[model samples]
Target: MARLRDRLTSLSQPRYLAWRALPLGSFDPRFARLRIRTLVMEWHRTRETPDDKAWCEQTLEALGHEVTPGIWSGEVNGLLWARPRESEARR
Candidate 1:
C-alpha cells in the first residue's frame, strides 16, 4: 500500500544520523571547521552577496564560533577555519 511504502521510506531515512554525528559534550574544533568550509562552499556556489556573508559570519560568532583566514588546499581563503571562541572554550 502507499501508506506502508511511505512508512518504510521514512524508516529507511537516517533521521538520527545528525544527532549521532554531533559532538557529545565539549566543543569540537574539527566539526566547526567543517561547518565553516561547507558554508563557504555554499556561498561560492550561490554567489551570495557580501551582506549574506556578513550575516553568516555574525551567526557563527553568535554560536561561539570564531572564523579566520587559513590555507586550504594550498590557497588562502577566508573562513577556512573555525574554532570555538576563547571564552566558550574555557567552559
Candidate 2:
C-alpha cells in the first residue's frame, strides 16, 4: 500500500529518524507539530522558483493545500498552511 511504502521511506530518512528519537516524555506536542510544519514549509520554499509564482500555486493545489500570499522582503511570497480540500473536509 502507498501508506506503508511512505512509512518505510520515512523510516530510512535520517531527519525522520532523529525526530522520532526525540524523548516523547519531554517533548511538547505543540512544539513537535510546529517543528514538523516549519520543516515542510522550508522544504517547499527551497524548491520554489522566485519568478514562477504559478508553479508554487499549482504545486500546493495538487497537494490539496490552500495557500495564502504574503509579502516577504519586498517579494510576494507564500505562507503555507495545509488544509484538506472542500470535498475531503466534508467527509
Predictions: Cα RMSD each: 11.4, 14.7
Please, what is the whole-model Cα lDDT of each candidate in the order they appear? 0.45, 0.43
lDDT of 1 by residue, 1-87 (tens): 999999988977753122223343333344443332222222221232334334445656766777654444221223334567767
Q: What residue pairs are clashing in model 1?
A: none
- The Cα error of candidate 1 at residue 37, in Å, is 14
Q: For model 1, what is the alpha-carbon lDDT of residue 36?
A: 26
| Candidate 2 regions with alpha-carbon error over 4 angstroms | 1-48, 70-78
Question: Candidate 2 on 1-91: residue-level lDDT in tens?
Answer: 9999999998786444222234422322343233222223321222333443455445555545555554332245444444546664454
The TM-score, computed over Cα atoms with residue i paired to residue i, of candidate 1 is: 0.37
TM-score of 2: 0.34
Candidate No. with top lDDT: 1
